[model samples]
Structures are given as structure tokens and as C-alpha cells.
Target chain A: MNFIDFIQAITEYDFLQKALVTSVMVGIICGVIGCFIILRGMSLMGDAISHAVLPGVAISYLLGINFFIGAVATGLLTALGIGFVSQNSRIKNDTAIGILFTSAFALGIILISFLRSSSDLYHILFGNVLAVRPSDMWMTLVIGIIVLGAIYLFYKELLVTSFDPTMAAAYGLSTRLVHYLLMTMLTLVTVASLQTVGIILVVAMLITPAATAYLLTNRLSRMIFLSAGFGTLSSIIGLYFSFTYNLSSGASIVLVATALFALVFIFSPRHGLLRKWKSPKKELTT
Target chain B: MYAVEVEGLSVSYFETTALEQLSARFTMGQLVGIIGPNGAGKSTFIKAIMGLIPSEATTITLLGLSAKEARTRVAYVPQRSTIDWDFPIRVLDAVLIGCYPKLGLFKRPRKQHRQLAMSCLERVGMQDYANRQIGELSGGQQQRVFLARALAQEAELLLLDEPFVGVDAGSERVIIDLLRTLRDEGKTIVVVHHDLSKAADYFDTLLLLNRRMIAVGSPADVLHAKTIEGAYGNPLAFLQKVEVSS
Candidate 1:
């Protein structure tokens, strides 16, 4: 369809409208906080929390509650449990996250099958942004505001804690508090985005912009803003592409972020592969 | 008054006692050096005092408060092992982490904070490298960055874990001068030091520990052959022979 036709279709169709707005909000949330996760080497934490929420949502659905609430609950429990368990179990953070996530996912699969709502589970995994109701949209916005505020109120702490928790702890900043808070935010953001982007694609949104921005900047503040901007831009462009090609908008947004990352990885002036690969003579001459 | 006081402090790994009932006190304006055999709780003593390790109650305290409460007043310059130097932050940014507790969240650094951090860097002779990524710096340069960070903290007490390892003599001289200057400014500095030869030259007090407090007093008294032998649990003759033969 043409641009005018596409705009008309988005305006006329509730599903398209929901997808667009939710995508932007998710973009903003993921973009800012993704920088935190990437800096802390907790990209896998996002994956872990997402899968861990499955069992909660499945059980809640079996009991007939709000799927999002169940997800948020499950995600927080898993995140906090992993946080405390990792400390006592002698397993590395990522390894603990891996173990917890897989178990939660397995339990979720079993529960969903038992509940006779595996199709709904499929929606949570692959997502159906088109089906987001007005209330769910509101929930996504609330979580977005929360994610944004948490990042803002805790920016300095998050920056230091993410890069060096030991120093943050030494500064009396309660590095553990910041860690748990970030996990809680991740829980909310993952649950909010689950309806629009699915579990697998959430990792892409949460990681791509930050990873791309890391290649281009050394300053933490710059990385956060640039990642957010890149995330929004990629979401919009990807939405347009998906609309035109009749593809999955969620996957399209992820692809756009991936494509941007590839470009930045090559062309970013600060630490780009090409820039680093330049010979010493070439650099000196330039 | 003691700037730092540790009593019956102990730390351990799964099967190792890094520190055992180690106790010491650091007074204001005192430069103290800690020397012991490897795995003899040199770094662990510092970590326990900094509350970086899980320790028993009443183990470590600073300025009469618990370590957590007094953390801001007690700056830590951790060993190179504790930092991932490959992180993509500039020297200035890394140094500025020292002032993070003061800055808190939701606020960026102001001119005063930057000035303090830059001044710290200047004291370490690394003012020009404020914008350079930390990973690009040499070992000495990295140590300077940590020194800059400690200086930026403006703490009453500074705890360092191996501040002189891998640094050249020139950088080492600069660090020693800075430490002396900080002491003159009425700060207490405790360093987990190697190099037994420089003990007298660098510090006013010496703490010789081998998983316990072997000696604690003026370097002249604590650096005696008997004290060294006691701390190492070996004869001074053997140590001297090893030193000369090397």
C-alpha cells in the first residue's frame, strides 16, 4: 500500500493503531534500559526473566486471572530468586539465570498444556500485537513510564553499579538494591512487551540499540540517549517495512535494530571494526 | 583516634582462610604498609576492612561506624584483579565513580565534581588522559586512575590493595609522592604492599600479617628480622638467601 493508504489503514484499524503505539512505548522502554543490561552483561538476564514469566502466566491463565499480572509476578519472583540463589549456590550469575529460566520455561510448557491454553502461550511467545486491547495498552504505558522513571531516578547508580558493582557497593550505594530494582524493571518491561514483541524478540529490542550505541560512544549518558533514539527510529522504520511487506512487525523491528547494529559495528567512528582495522600509517596520515 | 579499626576480622574461601582473627588500627595522617606472604591475608585484610568480604559481626569498622555506614568516608582503591580494565569508560569517568555516592542518582556531575576529578587526575600526572578509555592505559596508568579515583573521593581514609604492582619506578615515585601528600592533608592510608625493601621508605607504620596480626607498629620496630620471620613462619636467613639468589 501507498504511504497515504498505509496511514489510513493504521488510523482506521484498531489493531494497527495498537501495534504502532505499543511498539513506540516498548522502543523507548527497551532502548533506555537495554543500555543498562548490556553494560552489566545481563542481556541473558532479559532472556532468563522472560522465560521464567511463562509459568506464572500459564498458571494464572489456568486460574483465570490477568495474564500480564501473572507474568509480572512470575518474572519478579524468578528474578529475585535467581538473584539470591546465585549468591548462595556458587554458580555464576549467567549460569544461575540459565538454569532458572529453562526450568521455568519447562514448567510453563507443562502448565499451559495442562490448562488447555497452549495457543495463548503461543501468543505470548510469538506475540500478537494486533490483539492488544485498550486496557493492555494502558498497562504497557504504565510500565513504560515506570521503566523510564526508574532509569532516570537511578541513572547514576545504575551506570556505576552496572559497570562496577563493587565500587558502587563501596560507595554505600547499595549495589544489591540497584541490581534488584533493575531486575524488577526488567520484569515489568518484559511482561509489558510480551504482548507486542514475544519472548525471543524482546531480547533483540532490549539488546540491539544499546549494543549498537556502545560501539559508537564511550560516555554512558550518550550511550543511553543514542540507544533510545536508535530504538525508536528502528521501530518506526521496521513497522513501515512490515506494513508494506505484510510481515511480522515485531520481527521486522528486531531486524531493523540488527541491521542498524551491523552498520554501526562497521561504521561507528569510536570502536567500529573498520575504524580499528585501519593501519597505523593510514590513521596517522588521516 | 583511629581512622580504621578491625578486631577479630576473618575471611575465607570454600577451603581457605584468607584472614584469621586479623586486627589492626590506622590513625589519621598515617601511611601504613601491609606485607605478608601470598595467601597470607594481605588483600583479604583490606577487603574485610572495606566490608567487601562476608565477615563476622564487629569485624571491621571505620571512624567508629560500621563499614557500610562509613563507606563514603572510607575510599577503596582495589587491586587490579578487581577491575575489568577492558570496560569502555574514560579515565575521567572511572575516576568520577569515586564521587558517585556524593552525586547520587537522577543528577549528573557538576563543575565542582569535574574539577575535583580533574584535580585528582592532575595529581597523578594523568590530567591529559582524562578522556582516554581505561582499557587503553598501561598498568601504571591504570593504577594512576585508581589513585585519581581515591583522591576524588576525598575520603578521610584510603585503603589500597596492591597499589604498586607492575608499575615502573617513575609512576611508583609519583604514587608515593601523592600518598605522602594525601597524608599531609590529614588522610589515613592503608596499602596492601609487597616489596619488603621499600617498607621503611614508604610508610610510617608496618603491619605484618600472615592470616593474623604478626606485628603492628612503626616500620622500624615491625620490620625487624624476628617479626618478618614470625609473619612468614620461616627463618629470616632463608628469606634473605632467596632474595639474594633471585
Candidate 2:
């Protein structure tokens, strides 16, 4: 549907208004943090940590606390547990993260089953963006601002560390410090976006835009800006379609990101699938 | 004080001892060469000096200060084969990474950092291809990009591992000339090299290693026939048959 119809629909209902505003703010935060996740080679970890946040939220609900605070606490706990356990001079990072995230997710499932609010377990399992409160919208906005400020302040070092950890080491930037700080920031973003997009789609929120943008550019500065734009556009379009058709907002947002990924993957100039094939053009030139 | 000093250093990879109880020291402003057979500690010593290797050796200190402090003065270029070539990065941008330390965390590089990076690229005669992707460049050009990064660091001490191993002779000459100029400008340079033939002409000091310090001195003192035989082993037997038959 067109913008006019979408705005008309949003005005007609409180739920639509809440979903549209919340998803957009959450999208920008995930876009910025997801850039870091993609560059740092931690897309898998991003998925694991976001999934792990569910149990924390469920427990928070049980204890009558803010669900977002619970998710943030659990996310930080998971990220730290992964970082700390992997540093055990023996266990690799993947195993620790794998074990931690799975157990936490299992606990989250159990808690959700027992609590079973009127909305049903799957409501939180797959996010219900339309049910977001005004506080969630404000929290997402604050997260977006913080993520932007952090990226802007540490632009040079983050870029270098992502590309060359060894060189960054010689320059006196501690890899371990950057690694943990980034994980913490990632946790913050993951938890903040959970209400709008749900656990299952958060990875796509943080990774697809950045990974797709990577195909279209090599410069770091351009990569950040383009990925943010792609993410915001995905949220807006996805929100509109969900508003018109009454589809699941979480799945719709992810579908939008996946669509962008498909477009970039097939047609991107540098490393796209279509360009990678047909070396016949090279044969002709050579 | 010496620029670098290592005493009874040892490093192992899995079950293999790459460097075994090697000891050495070098004064300031010397152009040094580290030469050995394929399995010897030539590259290992460089890694050890750069603290890239996880080892229980004595210690590596650059200048008189601790290794971390001396880092601003010391830079390293790993073997050309060590990098992932397919990583999407531009030559100019890659070289500019050297300035990251000075800029620190959460800070954008100002005008001075850019000008420094450009000057380093100019010194290596790579000013024209600054915008090219690193993977698009030839082996020599890749090495030049690495060299430009080290130069951009403005390091007083440089440890380079196999800078010219697989590149063309022209690129090798360019590297040699650039290194010599760097040394002339009062920087200490050490390289891990495999070609024993040019050991005498290329460096002011020679260090021959085979899991240990086999020899260390001026090339005139260390490049004797016996030392070369000890380092090369009996590999010349196959080459001798080809020489005779041809």
C-alpha cells in the first residue's frame, strides 16, 4: 500500500502506531551494531546472544520487573559468559557460546511455557511489535543514539581492529578490551530490538544489512552509512506491508531484510553471485 | 644500549621447536639479515621479536623500554603468505591502519594522519595504486603495501619476515633499496631472508639460525663455505646431477 493509506491505517489503530514507531527506532540500533557484528566476524555469536536473551526476559516477567531490563541483563550475562568461559585457556569461543545460548534458550522456553500470559508463549517467541508500549519506543530511541555516539567516537580503531587485529595490537589497542566492549554494546542492541523483532529475527536485523552493504562497497565510512540506510528502509517498508496485510511483524521485517540480501547477493557489482559467474567476459578481454 | 636483545630464547609450535635457546643482540641503526633453511628459525625469530608467537622465551624489549612502550618505535610485517588476500580492503586504507595507534579508540584520523600515510606510500613508489584493492595487486605490490604500512608507523625499529620471498627480482631490488634508505635514515632493520647468495651484499650483519643461533656476525665473518654447507645440508646433490647432465 502507499504511504497515505499506511498513515491512515496507523492513525485508525493504537497497535499499528506503536508497531511502526517502535520497529523503526529498533531497526536503526540493530543496523549500527550489526555493522560491528558483521565486520568482527561474529554473526553466529550475534544470533546466539540474541536468542539467549529470551530466558532473561521471561524470568524478568516472572519477577515483575521491566522485560527489557531482564533481556539486557541476560544478554550481557550470556555475552560475558561466552567471553569468560572461552578465555579458560582451553575451550574455544564457539563451544562456550553454543552451550551457553542453547541452555539459556531452553530455560526461556520453559519459563514461557509456565507463565503463558494471555498472549500465548509464541507471542514473545516471535515478537509482537504491535503490542509494544510507549516506553519500548523511547528505550529503542535511546539505544540508537548511544550506538551512533559509540561508533562515531571509535571509528578509526574499530575499523583497524576489525581488519587487522595483529597490527592493531602493535599499536597498543587491546583486542581483548575491544572484544568485550563490543560484545557489551552488541548485547545492548540485541536486547533493545528484542521487543520489536523477537529473538529469531534479531540476527538478520544486525547482519543482513551490513553483510549486503559490504558487497556494494569497500570503504568503511560508506559501509556504515549505507548499511544504516538499508536497515531503516527495510523497517519502514516491512512496517507498511505488515500494516496493510496483517502479517506477523517480526517475520515481515526479516523477510524485508532477506529480500534486500537476495537483491545484493545476486546483483551486487563486486562479489555478487551474477558477477562471480561468467568469466567469459574476462576471456574475451584477455 | 642495543636496539634489541634476546637471550636464550626458545619457541615451539606443537611438537616442533622452531627456535631453540637462541641468543643475540644488535646495536642501533644496523641493517641485519636473518637467513636459514626452510625449517630453521628465521621466520620464528622474527615472530618472536614481534611477540606474535605465543612463547615462553626470555623476553623481547624494543629499545631500552618495555616491548609495549617500544611498540610505537617498532613495527612488523608478517610473511606475505600469512594474510587472507580475499579480504576486501584498499591499499591506501590498509596502509593508513598504521596510524590507528596514534588516533586511539573512538577517534577519527585528522589531516596529519592522512598526510603521513601518503608520504609512506610515496616512499615505496606506490603513490599511484593507492586506491586499488589489495588482492588486485601482484606479490611485489602487496609487499610494497605492507612496507608502506610499516613506514607509516614511523617506527625506528622494523622487523620484516620474508619481504621478498616469492616476488619478482625487480620488486626485491626495490625493497632492498627502500630498506637501505631506511637504515641510512637511522632506523634499524632486520629481515628474514632465504636467498643465501645475496646475504653478503645486502646486510651489515648476518644471523644464521637452525633451531638455534648457528652463527651471528658480519656477513664477512658468518658467510663462510662451512657455514653455508651447515645451513643448506646435502640438498645440492640433486642440483649437482642436473648441472653435470646439462
Candidate 3:
């Protein structure tokens, strides 16, 4: 179908409308939280939490409860496990992340093998955005609002702790509490994006758009807005491509986001490779 | 009342003793420089007192209050290397973080907070660079930004870790002058310094540390040969250097 037909198709089908709304909501929330994750050098931690939610999803399926509660529980468990292992022993943080996420992911695969509804597992691994229900869309919207609201409420605390925890503590703010709060927000955002991006591709939604905005902006607030803009735009474009070519929705979205990152990486005014190449003397001065 | 009082502050990392049974006291309005050799626990001492590191102290009080309660009235400028300068933030936003604790959890900074941050920036001569990206600054300028943030805290006690390291002469002079002004205004300042020769001239009091309190007194009394030898064994070389410089 052509562009006009695609637009018409979206309006005609409720499933398409739900898919479009869910993707945009997922993009905006992921983009917002991803800025903090990348700034705090927790990109690997984000990857670990996203992958680690698999076991929770499987358990939630077996127990017949909401997947979000299970996923959030497992995500928090992974975060705490990584923290405990790294903090209590000689093991570094990245090493702890690697150990926990791999094991958790492996356990999830094993758990899924024992389940009767294994076909449902396939959709969870690789998202089927077109099959998203209206209820799922509402859930995503509610979770998105909660995550964004928490970030807004704790913006200063998060900023101070991430920048300099020492100063944060000296100022009477609990740095540890802020750390856990951030991890909790990350968990919520990860769970919210699971249906739209799947387990494996959610980290891209969290990192790529924010990283792209990081290249273009000098302020965190600006980076957040720009990141959300890029995320929403990517979701729209990727959803269009998916509808037109029958592509995997999650992969298409990630690819579009990555392409945007590449464009900014080479063309951003102050930090871009192309800008440096154009003015070597100015680069040296900076 | 003394600005700081500690009976026995001990800290250990893994199996290594960082600071052992350190005891010291300082009066208010003193610019105290903590000078010690490498691995001598200068940073550890500051971090321990600030409760940044795990430590066991019998009695550690600041401004006659418990350490935890007194922290609200304290400002800390950590070492330059502890921060990620490439993280996307403006100079003004970074300084505005000082008001976060005052604003508590939900309340955002108002116009008055921004004006205070701007005034702090002006004190450090960083007002011109307030709109610039933090990563775009030089090392000295970045240090100044950190100092500006501490100034914005408006605390009664200030702890600075290696504020002069890698700083340009102009920035160094500006920082020293600002610190002295703060001291003159009845704010207690403690600086972690490395240069022994300049320590005598920079601080009104000297804290010679080597995993313990070697000496705590006027610069003239603490910079003597015996105390230098005690803190840093066989201190003939350092003593002669200090003697010649003085």
C-alpha cells in the first residue's frame, strides 16, 4: 500500500490504532529514562534489567498474574543482585551484571520450555505490535504516565546523585535511595516497553535515541525532549515500514532509531564527526 | 565552640588500614590544609569524616551536632576526577543542583534559587560560562564550576579535595581568594593539598596526616622537622625542601 493507503488503513483498524499509540508511548518513556541511564553509565545495567525480566514474564504466565508485577519484581531482583554481588565481593559491577543477566535469561528460556503456551513466548521474545490489544495499550499508557511523573518529581534528586553522589549525600539527600528510585523507574519503563520492543530490542529504544540526543544537545532537559522527539518519530516511521513491508515491528523501530543516531553522529554541529572534519582548527581550540 | 571534633576515626578497605585511630580538633574560621604523602590517607580522612566511606568513629561532631545531622550545613567539593564532565549538563544546571537538598523531594527550584546560583557563579568568575556546556570547559574552569556549586550551597563548613590540582594559576588565585573570603566570613574550610611547600603559606593551620593525626596546629608548629619526619619517615629531603622554600 502507498502512504495514503497506510494512513487510511491505520484509521480503519482498531488494532493498528492501538499499535501506533502503544509504540509512541513506549518510545517517549524509554527515551526519557534512557537519558538518565546513559548519563549515569548504566547502559549495561539497562541491558541486564531488560534481559533479566524474561524469567519474570515466564513466571507471571505460569502463575496467571499480570506480567508487569512479575517483570518489575524480577527487574528489581536483578538490580539488587548486581548491587549486592558487586558491593559485597571483589567482583566488578559489569562482571556482576554479566553473570546475573545471562543466568536469568537462560532460566527464562528453560522455564518457557516447560510451559504449555509456548507460542505466546515467541511473541514476547520478538514483539508482535500489530497484535497488541486495546487493554495492553492502556496499560502501556498508564505505566508511561507513572514513570514520567516519577522522573519529573525526582528530577533534581536524580540529577544531583548521578552527577556527584558525594555532594548529594553531603547535602542530606540519601544517595542510595535515589539510586534505587532510578532503578525502579528504569524497571517500570522496561516493563512498559516490553510489548512494543520485546525483551532483546528494548535496550536500543532506551539508549539509541538518548545517545543521539546527547550528541546534539548540551543540556539534560534539552536532551530529554530531543530524545523523546526522536523516539516518537522513529516509532512512527518504523510502524509505517512494518505495515508496508510486513517487517518485524521491534527490529524495524530499532533500525530506524539507529539510523537516526548515525545521522546525528556524523552531522551534529559541535560534537559531530563531519563538523570536526570541516573545521580542524576549531576542533583543536575546543 | 570548635568547628570540628573527632576522638577516634578509623577506616579500613578490605584488609588495608586507610586511617587508624585519627583524632583532631579545629576552631572555627580556620583554613586548614590536609597535607600528606601519597597513600597517606588525606583523601580517606576527608571521606571518612564526611561519611563517604565506611568508618568507625567514637565521636565525630561538626558545629556541635552529630555528623549526620550537621551534614546539611556542610558543602563538599570532591576531587575533579570523581565527576563525569561529558555528561550532558549546562554550567548553570550543575550549579543549581546545590539547591536540591534545600528544595527537598518534590519542590522545584524557583527564581530565587536561580538567582542564588547565578550569584555563586559570579563569585567564581564563571557567570560568563553559565550557559556553556560543562564538557566544553577547561580543567580549571571545571574546577571553578565545582567550587561555584559549593558556594551555592551556602554552608557553614566546606570540604574541598585537591581543588588546586591541574588548575591554572588564575583559577587557583581565584579559588584561594574565594576560600579566604569564606573563612573570613566565619565559614570553616578544609582543603586537601599535595604541595608541601605552598601548604604553609596557603592555610592558617596544617593537618599533617599519615594514616593518623601526626600533628594539628599552626603551620609553623606542624611544618617542623620532627613532625615531618614522623608523618613521612626519614623526611630529610622534604624538610630541606621546606626549609629552603620557607
TM-score of each: 0.91, 0.90, 0.97
TM-scores of the candidates, chain A only = 0.91, 0.90, 0.96
User: What are the per-residue Cα lDDT tens digits for candidate 1 across A201-244?
Assistant: 89889899989988888777888888988888787778777878
Task: Tell me, by TM-score, which candidate is best.
Answer: 3
Q: In DockQ terms, which candidate is top?
A: 3
Q: Which clashing pairs does model 1 show? A: none
For each candidate, give the TM-score of chain B.
0.92, 0.91, 0.96
Highest lDDT: give the candidate number: 3
Candidate 1 Cα errors over 4 Å, as ranges: A1-14, A280-286, B57-59, B104-108, B233-246
Locate the minimum summed-lDDT window of 10 residues in model 3 chain B. B234-243
lDDT of 2 by residue, A187-232 (tens): 7787677777778888888998888788888776777777887888
Residues B47-160, model 2: lDDT tens digits: 677676676666666787667678788888878876756555788888888877666655666788888888999988898988887877788888988999999888999989
Q: What is the TM-score of chain B in candidate 2?
A: 0.91
Quality of candidate 2 docking, DockQ: 0.42
Q: After the best TM-score superposition of candidate 1, give how far the Cα of residue A267 lies from its true spot, in angstroms.
A: 2.3
lDDT of 3 by residue, B1-246 (tens): 778888899999999999999999889999999998889999998888877778999988888888788877888999988888788889998999887767787999999999999999999999999999887887789999999888888889999999998888888999999999999999999999988888878999999999988999999999877888998786674666678856
